[model samples]
Target: MKWLGVLLAVAVAVIVIYKVNYPSYSYRYRLQVSIAVDEKIYTGSSVIEVVWDCGPKIAGLGRCAPSLGGPATLIDLGAHGVIVATLRSGENISPTPDGAIDAVWLCASAFGYRSTNEELPALPHLTGRRNLSVSNLPRLVWFVNPADMKSAQKVTFLNVASVFDPTAHFTEAFVEITRDPIVVDIPNKLPWFSELRRLQKEGKGTLSKSGQFQLVYNMFVGENS
Candidate 1:
């Protein structure tokens, strides 16, 4: 009787511990994007559907494209709409490199609101959402109408990656620029935003308002096949 009682106590203790700790954990997000192409004028709307924590292996995913890190604009000029979504899994990584894949290139440009002549703030950021806990979708440089001034926008240059490596494939799903706002999911709360912003405040990123942020380096945004 004593042995049986001890065994039952251990089982109860294990069950109680698991039940109490399980609720504290958060779930993963499975991002799914839907793209539509206009084919007539190279523009459209993108529907991004997301499913949480549904993955076989998280790292096994690929860059937006099979090889191209992502998109300079991420919009398929041929298609009207584009969708981008991410998933979470057990440390997924691509096993094979797509023949059409290329390195992620850092590109830059000036931002300004055309009609109002309002310029954007040059804020420094840690980069994409890769490992961070939260993703940040900042406004990119572009022209907008005065009446369209909804928010004081800020965005540096966009890093455009080519999948074709000047010799392969470059495919876009689809999208509309003026209408479709830039929506990028960064990692959770990043560790570098505060410091990067501090640099921006200290005028360390660039001295001139027009002075662009220099290309720090090309990060390998590679995904497994």
Candidate 2:
């Protein structure tokens, strides 16, 4: 009986240790986006899942941090009227003496037209040093009495910086982040997965010539130890 009790104690300890070292957590986002162009409003929604696990860490180097268990689920809003939506994910690494911080980000863009036959306007050239990075480009644009689809008329642009700017006074659009549980495998069954995979293969370096609206979402995850 004493030997049996000892065995039970050892089993419990091993389970606890495994749980601590291999912990997993995930966050799910349901994004709904609406864009108004001319007299029409276009809308779309997407579900994104991100999972992390507290993997092994080197001793005396840094704290134990979670690593992505697998590739994050991508977002594809599909075609809403003449507007087509696209999303892609990537990581940015910032190194430290002891470790490195990984910033995983998602970039969202949309292409729109008055009609399928109408040629979409070219994306405006980003001016000034602050606009150099693709991440810095505007997510939403408000056109005011455009002369034509191809005309480079004056328009309002909204990016991450401008959204937080006190003077920008952006009231029409907003981005939200929250902690919510999700089924990790749900994205695989989604109808848009094939198309989203194609976009992911294309990567962020290439911009769609037909793209007009762009937005970026960033989340900081594990540190390499």
Candidate 3:
């Protein structure tokens, strides 16, 4: 009886340690991209999931880290497409008090270099910080290649649209961020099975809804590739 009690205590301690160090919390969002070439537009979207794991700190030596999940192929414009565009979400994860995402770094780039061997001019590129909680939802950020502008100027949220010329030789890009809801379904297997069954009993089981930020962009390619 004493040996059985000892084994049970050790098993309980091991479970507690595993739950503390191995379990992870995650935040998910979607990234969508659209490119316009001539009269047709090509669009694609992918889910961006960030998982945070709290590591065991050995004398304060270890730190928590975040892992990102998404499709390996972001989007394939097409074989005959004139423009190539990409959207990337930063790995920096900082959640708000209400468990929502606070802010994230977003970067977008669009160019027409893939379709031609000719050395094209500078393309549209932008990297900026987006505040999700306090800022207005569905905010738009625009970018224009410096080669298209006659005068050198910085693009801001208010004056970015003015810099873009519809008849330019290069491509112009516009990125927007919006709040969308996503449903996360926990699988009934391994460590999550017990938690899933518990939630199932409360009618909150298989699926849980969470907020997601949809980062969508539109890139317009001019004729001169």
Scored by TM-score, the top model is 2
lDDT of 1 by residue, 75-121 (tens): 23221122111111111132211111111111101111111111111
* Per-residue alpha-carbon lDDT of candidate 3 for residues 1-225, written as tens digits (9 for 90 to 100): 999999999999999888665554444345454444444555544443434455564656345454444321122334431121222211123432223221122211121122111121111221222322222112222212212211212222223234432321212223233234432221211123345445555766333122322221111111111
Question: What's the lDDT for all of these models?
Answer: 0.23, 0.30, 0.31
Q: What residue runs in model 2 are displaced by over 4 Å at the alpha carbon?
A: 1-12, 60-103, 106-225
Candidate 2 accuracy as TM-score: 0.36
Maximum-lDDT candidate: 3
lDDT by residue (tens digit), candidate 2, 1-225: 999999999999999887665554444334344444433444544444434444533454323232232222222222311111222222122232212112222211221211111121121211111111223222222212122112211122344223322233222322223344433332343333344445545675222223332212221111121
CA error at residue 206 for candidate 2, angstroms:
12
| lDDT, model 2, position 9 | 100
For model 3, name the residue pairs that clash: none
Candidate 2 structure lDDT: 0.30
Candidate 1 stretches with Cα past 4 Å from truth are 18-23, 26-30, 39-225
Candidate ordering by lDDT (highest first): 3, 2, 1
